[model samples]
Target: MSFLAPIPLPAPLTTRALNALRRDIVTTRLAPGETLSEATTAERLNLGKAPIRAALAQLAAEGLVQPVPRRGWIVSLVTVRDIHEVFDLRLLLEPEAARRAAASAQDRAAAAAPERLDAVCRAGYRPEDPASALGFLEANRAFHVAVAELSGNARLARQIGRLLDESTRMLVLGLRRRDRSGEMAHEHRALTAALAAGDAAGAAALMREQVAASRAMVLAALTVPDAATVA
Candidate 1:
């Protein structure tokens, strides 16, 4: 009797697994403090248990997932304190990064950031559509991260990226409650103009304002009753 050969497994799924979990967390689909089962996740994503475990480990390093004593991993909750801490760090880093980026605007790579930011601003935010909101959030993160990268400091870009990642869920929550995407787009537009003009001080000031506004909106949203389930 002839037997069929077993199907070969796909290439490493760690990146795909990580991205799926990350998107779920940020979108609040998994909800904060929810327990995660590797086997269940593996089945849900149609991935192997090894990749799910690996993804969880990666997320733990990023502060999005925490291992419990006996239970499986739990999604980390974003506290008011966490919001303040993240914004405080952003206030310290992003303004300086923007200033440096503006100074380095003459560089070909750095000069391209303004165009990217313009594209994001043009995309705007869509409150009526959930998918559009997620798209806008991704674009928003890309724009900020791009500005940091334009500073020509790899370490600084990485730091800003981490801060942005941590703050994403809260930003999404705030966006769902409030429609400030237009104002956000306007701010981004002005910031891009400043960066393109090589105005270091202006760019720094604009970055500070953007971070401050985001902090205010997020914190305000979190204070409302039952806001955690708002999304």
Candidate 2:
């Protein structure tokens, strides 16, 4: 007879709890501003209260959750102002990053940037399938971050990754409000071609246009009276 392996401790348990909560929030399953009840979360996730609390604290630090004075934790709400701020930061960095990535992609003969982006564009999204919304968001985020990484700038890539995380939530909400997946995939294909061809200026311009359009869509969605219900 063999002895049973020891169960993992709270640190690892908290990490698993954190990832579950984060996925729910990012995928809109938790919904913006939904109160997080510890008991309910623990019961639903089959986790202990200790790990849930630890996960909430970490999520709050990431701006994905907010702690109320006397109530409990709530999923952070995205506002029009938040959209503007996030896109403003992206606009400042992404265009330049794309230009650099174009040059880098040209020098690396075996670069997979074009192929990776193409795969995402080809996969596209199905408006009728609700699950496709998350797939679209993940693909979109991967394409952007991959472009940034191809720039050969670690700091720039890290910054873009963080911005993309915040942008994913807005994009998911926008997709629910309006089906722009086809248009977005088309734009990604064009941008990928420009990068592969080393057209730095064209790539930069395309990236700017893409970010601006996404920002406009999200802002417009937030302005609707039933925006909350739509998502």
Candidate 3:
């Protein structure tokens, strides 16, 4: 008989549960305003009630979910105002970042800068596969972060990182319709080429156009009638 020592159990349940809930909620799989019950989540995940409760509490802290007075936890609803705020920040930050990336490419001092935008465009084009969206989001972040990092301002980079997180979070929430993903990818590719070619003015112009288009999309999503709102 092979003697086997008792397998050590993994870390505590609550952390595992919290991560699972956060992943599903952030990815839009749970959908905005979707109510979550501890019992149902626990059963569905094969986790204990204690863990599920703990997880929901943490998600509430992240503003991804909220507790109702009498109902239960529901996905947080992002308002039109929220969309405006996110895009407003994007408009303020990204244009300048793109300019810097273009300058860096022109000088040939920033080897990684050019590829950053390329990677983001590549990832965005992979949106047809839902499993790839997370990677796309990560690459998108890396692109913005690269530009900021090459700006030679640590504070600016950190600020850009925080703002980009908020913007991407809202974008991910609103990107429920994958029909237009190809169009978005093309826009990104154009922006990338402008940056890589060391065309500062062109990159800045493209960045402005991209943000403006994004703002329009968000407004339309907020106001236009959709089956998503029919419930």
Highest TM-score: which candidate? 2
Question: Candidate 2 regions off by >4 Å?
Answer: 1-10, 229-231
Pick the winner on lDDT between candidates 1 and 2. Answer: 2
- Model 2 residue 208 distance off true place after TM-score fit, in angstroms: 0.4
Tens digit of per-residue lDDT, candidate 1, span 133-222: 777878888899989988889999999998998788888888878877888889899999999999999999999999999999998888
lDDT of each: 0.87, 0.87, 0.71
* Model 1 lDDT-worst window of ten: 1-10
The 10-residue segment with the lowest total lDDT in model 3: 222-231
**What's the TM-score of every candidate structure?**
0.88, 0.90, 0.70
Compute the lDDT for candidate 2: 0.87
Residue 130, candidate 1: how far off, in angstroms?
A: 2.0
Q: If both were scored by TM-score, which would come out higher, candidate 1 or candidate 3?
A: 1
Backbone collisions counted per model = 0, 0, 0
Error of 2 at 64 (Å): 1.3
Number of residue pairs clashing in candidate 2, backbone atoms closer than 3 angstroms, sequence gap of 3 or more or interchain: 0
Cα displacement (angstroms), candidate 2, residue 140, comes to 0.5
